[model samples]
Target: MSIISSTSHATSNTATLSQRLTAAIGASILGACLVYFAGFSHIEAVHNAAHDTRHSAAFPCH
Candidate 1:
């Protein structure tokens, strides 16, 4: 009985971890898209800010 319960508990934890990981990846992709679009924005301030951010992160934008 204890073994069965422990197995179910582990499965539940794995599912929760997977869900969190998926959400984190989705959020990261969405944030990257926002930054990329902002870098190409017509607004000079937004474009500059994104460019600076990329440089600060050591991500070459050129």
Candidate 2:
């Protein structure tokens, strides 16, 4: 009986871990899509923004 109960508990834990992993991966894909669209939609704007940011951070762009 004790072994059965422990096995059930482990199965539940595995299910929970899998669900969390799926959610995390979905969120990451969604975020990547958003960034890709935003950056690619206006290439010039994104490049200018990044250039300004680098200057602000004192990074030598030249």
- Which model scores highest in lDDT? 1
Tell me how many clashing residue pairs each candidate has: 0, 0
Q: Where in model 1 is the C-alpha error above 4 Å? A: 1-18
lDDT of candidate 1 over 4-53, digit per residue (tens): 54434444434588899999999999999997789779999999988888
Q: Could you report the Cα RMSD, in angstroms, for every candidate shown?
A: 7.1, 8.1
Per-candidate TM vs. native?
0.50, 0.45
Q: List where candidate 2 sits over 4 angstroms from the true fold.
A: 1-15, 42-62
lDDT of 2 by residue, 1-62 (tens): 35554444444435588899999999999999866665456678876776687789998978
